[model samples]
Target: MLPPLSEKELDRLEDLLITYGNDYSVLNLAELNGFFTALASSPTTVMPEQWLPAVAGGKVPKFKKPAHEEAYTALMLRYASQVAEELGDDVDHFEPLFEESEGEEGSVIIMEEWCFGYMRGTQVAGWAELPPEQDQLLKAISLHGLEDNFELLDQMSEADIQACVPQVTEAARRLYRYHRLQD
Candidate 1:
């Protein structure tokens, strides 16, 4: 079984985000905060070269000194799944309504000047993703600054993960948004 990624092993992910993430990601708070904790200690385990999936064709994209959208999204999906298991099956569906809105952005010009889908209505498609209010379901996460496992943070024992719920949703949504890349 793949070991639960140690705090250190998971850290390489932060570095990867900074090196290959985009502008939107650079502004994220989760990456910055998470990286800080990881740096506090040395890796109890060594990071294998294959730790991360090969950057297809080795054409790695350049990002800022922090994680961006992709990292955020991955974080969320993971949290959602984990939380679902912990909270029981009923909670998973409301964990986060991850959706994709790429070319569809600005498709609805609400006042001809203000749009909705970019971030505002991203959660509305199937529903929205807002943070700070965890009645569950955060689709277009306004909780952007988070990079820990938030889903079960409040309920877990002290030794549990930090649950970056917003990031998890973003990653799930992004996968669908960029599905064409796979084609």
Candidate 2:
């Protein structure tokens, strides 16, 4: 198994992505984590060639040096592998990397970016029409991730959104298990 990235390495990767510029549609660390998680949980394997370009917003970045390119690719692949292993080995304990902010009510989990990334992963995987039961699992992620749901989400109180956090997490876990069972 590939070694997991160190905290310092993760920070470095995040910095590298930012340096690449938002104009390129680069994903931040939290979003990347969510993206990887979704890819890892996908019923079908998504090759790097298929998803790497998606990471760079449809165009692969031109690295300044071969070493930089190698390091970046290695880090991303290892991180993705780690996510797959984590979910495959223990779906019940899988935890998403969500950002948190201090709201008036105290700390609030920011699921938007992560969920958006996950939804992107599902798209990259070209998910087929799922059964209603499984579709609900995907909807949990979409409710927070998709801009189309913004109006519906707006109607929810902070507490309501907070309450949905566990549901989202559980939904992801269940989705993973459901796909694994199909294998």
Candidate 3:
């Protein structure tokens, strides 16, 4: 069991969020091969709880259509499930790139999700937040550095879904950054 992010590192993580605009950039790094331990143990170093209350909690109040936050949360959950299953119990042993998703809810009042998954994640709700009936949202999803032939959310067994979870998440996290932060 690694320790949580220290105050100093948390500050840097916060700064990183401000610089990039989205938190996923810092959260998805286990694939990088370095700093995995540091991130897993102390994800708050990069993902800062400060942002959670504003974004994840009902504080900021989305109050808009097309809830991007919820989409992001679901994507994170998919990643967590994959990481938990693939990495198994060893997940927490290292600095988990993504924490397990926990306590998620959607409603008309507050869009912000309580979000405890993905080590910790953010949530939101809004109109058209559904996964889409015709593969629209899934189409938007693309895991990084995946097999060219690999199709996301397509025909496969539970085992396939499980294996693709982390890859799917990496894609979402990357897309989230590119959509919001990356110019």
Candidate 4:
């Protein structure tokens, strides 16, 4: 099995992404984690060719060196593979790579980018209308990820948002398990 990305490698990958030209909509590390998780857990396979462009904000970036491009691709594939292995080994322990910030109460999770990435993964996979239960699970993710729900989220209190955290986490796990069962 391929090894997971080390912390240094992850930082390097993040650096590469940040430097990938201002014109491109490259995903940050958190979003990339979410995107890869979604793809790994997707009911159907999404080819790298299809999702790779999506990661670069819908267009592939031009690297100064072919070696740089190769390295970038390799890092991404390895990270995605790591996510898949984690999920495959045990969905129950799967954790989203969410960022956290100090709030008045404590550390608050910043799930927006991750959720958005997951939603993008679903889009890339061309997910069809799911059954009611599965759709509900997907909705848990969309509630936090999609900008369209900003107004709704705005009205929610911090406590409410916090409450949704476990729901979102469980939703991801259940979604993965649900799809795996079908396989």
Candidate 5:
């Protein structure tokens, strides 16, 4: 199995995205990882060319540092491998982007981004004629992306929001599995 992403790696990636002047959205490494996994699971064939532009939030800005670009490429390649392994069910280890350090509010933000990225990836991948159930799941995820949960965040207790994390993560996983099953 491939190793999990280190905090340093995520920090480096974030720095690279900033240097590249990301303007489309605020996406963390975890979200990117989720996006790539969704792309891999998608029924449509997605090329690196398509993914690069989509993740760049529409444009692929030139990297300020050549080394950072190379690192980013390597990381993407790893994500690709992860998709393959996941589809085969040959790997079991996985980590959601949000963990303990992110806390409830941070977790909500990251998960929303992650779902948004997955939705974007599926669209870019040209996912075709999804099964009814999967299509419904896609719609739900899209809603999650568009919803202004921040205001609600205050109304809900931290523990209550955090409690929803597992369910949200499971939904993503189920969506991923649903696509694979259709294959």
Candidate 6:
């Protein structure tokens, strides 16, 4: 699997998003990664148009310097492409953007953020109604986002969730594949 985003790269993108506006206040490096990854996985090829609003909170900022805009576009594409490549592989290996934290609570929080990002993805992609099968995954993401996985965490121990990380990653790949085959 390709190495995940480095701290420096994440910090740079995070700062750039912050500059855009408060709409991005809820987003972070991992959520951004999740959003772009979801978009890349979709059948649609429209990147900047959809991505700008999603990442920038529905408004693309006019950077004083053109390099900032160019750089952001390039990085976002690069990261999403990375996720697409990894998911496209035949192996059953996939990693979520969030790293494991110290305790179950930390991991729960990370899943909450990831789910929230994925939920945002469903909206920004304009996928109002997914197929029943794919919609199942979308619904799970929505439920997790709404509940923030706290309920799930309460029901299942962190180790249980941790053990299922591979499953979650695989589900993401399935979501990608499902959309990639859509009309």
Error of 1 at 58 (Å): 18
Encode model 2's per-residue lDDT on 1-183: one tens digit a residue.
888889998987887777664554546888888898889878899999998888888867888888778877888898889888889888899989889999998999989888988998898898888999999999999999888999999999999999988988998898888887663
State the C-alpha lDDT per candidate.
0.30, 0.86, 0.32, 0.86, 0.64, 0.65
Quote the RMSD, in angstroms, for model 4: 1.5
Q: What's the best-to-worst order under lDDT? A: 4, 2, 6, 5, 3, 1
- Report the alpha-carbon TM-score of model 5 versus the true structure: 0.73
User: Which ten contiguous residues of candidate 4 have the minimum total lDDT?
Assistant: 19-28
TM-score of each: 0.26, 0.94, 0.24, 0.94, 0.73, 0.73
Structure candidate 4, residue pairs in collision: none
Q: Which stretches of candidate 2 lie over 4 Å from their true place?
A: none
lDDT of 3: 0.32
Better of 1 and 3 by lDDT: 3
Residue 181 in model 3: shift from native, Å? 7.5
Candidate 5: Cα lDDT at 149: 46
Q: What is the lDDT of residue 10 in candidate 1?
A: 45
Worst window of 10 by summed lDDT in candidate 6: 104-113
User: How many pairs of residues in model 1 come into backbone collision?
Assistant: 23
Error of 3 at 162 (Å): 1.4
Per-residue C-alpha lDDT of model 3 across residues 28-116, encoded as one tens digit per residue:
22321112221222213334234334332323224243544554443333333343343334432323233233333321211011111
lDDT of candidate 5 over 1-183, digit per residue (tens): 786456686677776666664558435765676677677677666778878877777877677778878987776666566655654563234444553455535533335666666667777887787678777666556644545545665687666655666665666666666766643
User: Which segments of candidate 1 are over 4 A away from where they belong?
Assistant: 26-183
Task: Give candidate 6 misplaced runs (Cα > 4 Å).
Answer: 1-7, 24-26, 62-65, 104-109, 147-167, 181-183
For model 2, which pairs clash?
Answer: none
